[model samples]
Target: MKLRQKILLLAVAPLAVAMLGIALAVRFQATQLAQHERALVEAAYLQSKETELRHYVELAQSAIAPLVRSGRTDAATRQAAMEALARLDYGPDGYFFLYDLHGRNLMHPRQPELVGQDLWTLRDPQGALTIQQLIAAAKGGGGAVRYLWRKPSSQQLAPKLGYVVAVPEWGWMVGTGIYLDDVESTLRQLDARAETDIRQTMAWIGVIAGISILLVAASGLALNVSEHREADAKLRQLAQRVVQSQEEERARLSRELHDGISQLLVSVKLVLETATNRLRLAPAEGAAVAPVLGMALNRLDTVFNEVRRVARNLRPALLDDLGLYAALQHLAREMQGGSGLEIAVTQSGTPRELPDEQATALFRIAQEALTNVERHAGARRVVVALAFDADATRLTVRDDGHGFDVARMQEDPQRGIGLRNLRERIAALCGQFDIVSGMGGTQLVASLPLARPAAIAHDPVSAGPSPS
Candidate 1:
């Protein structure tokens, strides 16, 4: 992957994971909390129903209190009590019921047909003995029991909570009950609302995660665009520098030919013309013409030597003939003779052959460093060291001169061209280049890996000279 894509992934992946984990945790906790709330609500509703049922049973007992307290157990008193209870209902589905100790129905206001039936073995859909459970609650000194029963209003079986009390004097079970469909309906609504809220929460988390990832990706894209712009600008600057350098080199060569070799050729031509005139005028003056011709031959020799010097400056033939070592040695000798600087060239490890492109790049780097030292460093002594290792080659140039600011010089486009060229050449070979300058001296080092070829076939700045 490209670096931009990797950066975006690194920034967004973790955030997405964390958001997903948070959503899951919220869903789990919300579900658990909803269940707990539902239990609390159901319990509270059932407790209220139990209390209402107990109150209805008390009211029924009050209606029959006069007969029971008057010590009457006759059939008429029993009939009167049953009639009173039959009339003592609160709502259409609310009523009091009576059962004998043997589970025979005594009085049932809602279902009159059940009043005379023996219902001890009767079971609801859930297999619970409904009448027996009610009688048991009465026999246990008045409490509540839950079971299924037909609701009078709906005429369908629904859950019921019945409260009952025992009347020992008459062998009767007095009870009242409230159907629980309303409580369940309320809880169902609550559960639906809770589910909707959880879904919304999860959706919001997803939206936030998506937005965060998009923001990070946008930032990475912006960074990549900025870097690309900077690279393009530097490339344009490098192209301009290459053109300017070529023009400057051509100008120098033109000046050398015009000022040195051209003058010598003109002097030689004048001497030859004088010798030719003398030979044409007097054949006996041939000895004088020979002396003039000899002078012309001497000037011609100077012109040839100057031409050789210019050609050597353009590209050293010694490099192709004997390799980098001999070329560097010759360069040091020539520079020392001209600049009067103590220049030394040394090598370490066994010599190794290199690709032409790599060798040429290194040679150019060395040449640029020495030129900088001679022209700007004002150094008395210079050392150039070349080392060959198992897998790499290193070149170091040091000069004992008053140093200049490395950063400042590199920042100056006009003054830093030579240093920049040296660095570019090393970079084209995929090598490491380092330069350190201070009041003490300046040291420039370039190290290239032997196993790797040049990243490019040629460097633009150093395209002139290469080993054959």
Candidate 2:
């Protein structure tokens, strides 16, 4: 390998390692962060479940409250209350259960066989005597406990969180429980989603690292590739801004035509009418009508001048009538009026009549390029070049003024407005767009293929004379 190639490898290898390290670091941080978030998600689920269980149990209490308070201790009254609670069911696997002070089930809503069963000695998988603990908690004013119970929906053992309360006058406990498996499943789903997002982030980091490793020799371009995503986002926004600007310009032009040129033409018309009336109806003759004729002629001249100015602003006549070559010449002459800048035009190969879209795009690009140069390029001279060949057309505008950073301008909305539009225009034609700039000078280059035109005229922004 050449010395340059070897040195390039040495520099690239470490950068590649560093990038891998960063990817791993980011993955680790994401995982740790996601784990903490998972706990919060689980906590939120648990808290909500607790609240719902309390509400459901309260509903059961409300149903049984009237019966227990009726000032009657008859066995029939107790059976009525038990039967009423048993019929109460809200959702799937949701119901009320009752247990006597002695540990026999009173009203097992879904499992009637458990009514007479002795469950005080029955233990869950965790070896906790489930009924005994619940009875103790209920007797001690009422609270909640966790254990394994058969799910009413699936008849499978599942973790449950139950709340129980005592009926002091009736020697019974009433309670309800919510299945905890739902909370677990929800937490698991969140954890799975978090893992998927982390994998995706790691994938993106790997892609960026792989790219950096491959292009270490062109680090600036690599950095620019990362920056290109940001630029693409801005480009989408610029597209809308460019459209709004064109519409605003069109509205301004329309106003000027109506209020400025239209009024002038009306004045000119009135002047000619008066002149014609004087020659026909008045006694004045010869030199007497000469002054009126001269005044009419001056008004006509003013109207003609106004029309040309508006026409040029709408779409340069030279550009439409004479083609790009003559239009560019006119453009240079216009910019050199008061500006301290010398603009030059050069062409190579033969100039042909391009389609309206192609000719217009080239002219507008040059017009905008010159406008930017005159406004920002504090240079003494600028060169506008047009080149045509068998396969493509190219236009370049270079300025000797203190050239600004092309990359910086592209990233900044205020600075890179026209250059961006020039690029989009050329690129629409399946062409290449490039800008090379430094402290000494800046050059904007665009090339369009001769293949059947692909670029449509999207911008109507007349670059002839921008409004102040």
> How many residue pairs clash in all the candidates, one count each?
0, 0
lDDT of 1 by residue, 103-181 (tens): 9999988888897899999999878898888888888899999999999899999888999998888999988888888
Q: Record all residue pairs in model 1 with backbone atoms less than 3 Å apart, i.e. clashing.
A: none
- State how far residue 68 of model 1 sits from its true place (Å): 8.6
What TM-score does prediction 2 earn? 0.45
Which regions of candidate 2 deviate over 4 angstroms? 1-236, 251-263, 266-281, 338-340, 453-468
Worst 10 residues of 1 by lDDT: 459-468
Query: Lowest summed-lDDT stretch of 10 residues in model 2?
Result: 459-468
**Best candidate according to TM-score:** 1
lDDT of 2 by residue, 1-468 (tens): 955567667888788888888888988898999988988887776788778877888888888789888979898999999888888887877888999888888888788889888787898888989999999999998888889999978989999989898998999989988888987788788889989999999889888887777667687556556667777877777877879888999998888888877887788778777777877887667567777778777877887887887788678987766667778888888888768679988887766546667778888888888888877778889999888777777888999989888788877766677677778788787789888999889898878777454433333332222212
